[model samples]
Target: MQKLLEGLIKFREIDFEEHKELFGQLSKEQNPHTLFIGCSDSRLIPNLITQTLPGELFVVRNIANIVPPYHESEEYLSTTSSIEYAVNVLEIENIVVCGHSNCGGCKSLYASDEVLNEIPHTKKWLELAYEAKTKVLAEVSVEEVDKREWMTEQVNIVEQLKNLLTYPFIREKVSQGTLTIGGWYYLIETGEVFIYNKENGLFELAN
Candidate 1:
């Protein structure tokens, strides 16, 4: 808590002062260039990784960076609403769905049913990874737990990208050539970012 307070003080004293003009303009409104959807992990800092400044990237974060399929019947879906607003209102041209390695949410998906049952909401939320889990199970032979985890992490990014397209606004934007959707896997240990290439059906390090 003290560290956070000191950081806040530093932000006001140095960081905020350094970008005073940017902060001043941001006080009026924000027109971000990209909508960054990433995992709600303390280790994964989207702005730091992307090297973006304030008001540049609109962000939506959740466990495992999951983007649920569009559903009108579902009430109080904040993630979906944020996506809609970013595209329709903010007019962000790029939407990035970023997943990271060593994700607990991805690990939980592979846990036994008994363990999963303890966290009912989490179990339901992670159902978005069902197809990814199935694909990993079928394609990847996992003799080691770490290998299985790595596969799951990669597959989850692919799955969420598919889920993002389910939104009508997203589909429309893509069709109009006004928006580009990207799936990213951030390797925490290696400090490397891999982007999914749809044409090749593989993830390559982002240049």
Candidate 2:
């Protein structure tokens, strides 16, 4: 808590002081270009990883970067509201669902009942990636356990992208070419970002 307070003071004295005009302008309004749906991992900082400035990316983070398929009922309002506002009001041009290596949420999908029962809400939320887990397990060999988890994480990103399209408004914008959707995999150890290539159906280096 003390560290955070000190950082806040430093930010006001240095970072904020340097970007006074930018912060002032952003104080009034924010018009971000992209809606970045990433995992709630402490290591994976979206702004730091993307090198984006304030008011650049409107970020919505949750466990495993999961975006559940759009439901007509207003259930899960927290995630849904952000998606709706970003698309309808903010009119964000791009929606990027980013998954990372060594995601606890992805790993938890394979956890035993004993482990998951303690966190029932988390267990229920992770059900959104069941399709990803099932698909990856069927395709990836059991011998390659590490590879399976990596594949599952990447597969989850693709699954979430498909889920995002389930929203009528998002699909309409995408069809009109006004909005674009993408998936991303972040290698936590190496700090390298890989983007999904729809044509090749694989994640390739973003070079």
Candidate 3:
């Protein structure tokens, strides 16, 4: 709490002051061009990773960076609602779903009933990544933990990219060539991000 308070003061006195003009303009309105869907991992900072300025990326973060397939109901869908607003309202040009190496959320898919029972909501939420889990397990051996870790992370990004198309508006925009969609696998330790190539079904280093 003390550190956060001091950081707030420093930001107001230094960072904010330095970006006064940018903030003042943003105070009027924001017209972010990209929608960034990522994980809630403390190690992955979206703004820092993208080198994007404030008011540039509309971020939606959650466990595993999952995107539940489009649905219609009288439900409070947090991530869904954010996607709706970012696309239908903001008219974002690009949607980037990023997954990272050694994702606990991905690993949680394999958690036993005893462990997941402690957090029922989280267990339910992780259902979205089951397809990715199934795919990775089919190809990787249990002994190859490292391969499974990265494969699950990358495959999960591809799954979410497919899920994004489940939204009708997004599908229409993509079909009409008005909107672009992509998946990214970020290596936290190496500071490298691999871009998912849909045509090749592989993650290529963004070099």
Candidate 4:
């Protein structure tokens, strides 16, 4: 608590003072450039990774960085609604779905029922990412822990990108070349990111 308080004071005294005008302008409205959908991992800082400032990236974070396929029944859809607003309302140009290394959410896809049952809601939420597990299992043996982890996290990014296209608006925009979608795999240990290239269907170093 004390650390957080001091951090807040530091932000106000240094960071805020340096960007006072930008914040004042942003107080009225935010015109973010990209819709960054990333995992709710404490180590995965989207702004820091992207080298973006406060009003630059409109971020939506959830466990595993999952994007549920477009649906319209009657449930509280936070991430979906945020994507809708970023595209339709904000008219944002880019959408990025980022998955990271050593993600607990991604690893949970391989968890035993006994383990997952302890966190029922998380189990349910991870259903959106089960397809990635299926792909990983088919490609690599579960006994190969490192290979399984890499495929699970990166394949999850591909799955979410596919999910994003399920939205009619997103699909139309993508087809018309107005809105672009990207998949990113972040390596927490090495501070590196890989970009998925749909052309060759490979994730290459973002550098």
Give all TM-scores, in the order shown. 0.96, 0.97, 0.98, 0.98
Error of 4 at 141 (Å): 1.2
State in Å the error of residue 49, model 1.
0.4
Error of 2 at 112 (Å): 0.3
- Model 1 RMSD in Å is 1.2
Q: Residues 63-176, candidate 2: write the lDDT tens digits.
A: 999997888774557788899999999999999999999999998988899999999999999999999999998987756879988999999999999999899999999999
Per-residue accuracy of model 3 over 42-74 as CA lDDT, tens digit each = 999999999989999999999999999999979
Question: Which clashing pairs does model 2 show?
Answer: none
Cα lDDT tens digits for candidate 4, 22-114: 999999999998999999999999999989999999999999999999999688999999999999999999999999999999999989999
Ranking by lDDT: 4, 3, 2, 1
**All candidates: CA RMSD in angstroms?**
1.2, 1.0, 0.8, 0.7
Ranking by TM-score: 4, 3, 2, 1
lDDT by residue (63-157, candidate 1, tens digit) is 88999999996589889999999999999989999999999999998788999899999899999888888888897665667878988998889
lDDT of 2: 0.93
Cα deviation at 106, candidate 4, in Å, is 0.7
Off by over 4 Å in 2: 74-76, 141-143
**Comparing 2 and 4 on lDDT, the stronger one:** 4
- List the global CA lDDT of all models: 0.91, 0.93, 0.94, 0.95
* Strongest candidate by lDDT: 4
For model 1, the run of ten residues with the poorest summed lDDT:
139-148
Candidate 1 runs further than 4 Å off: none
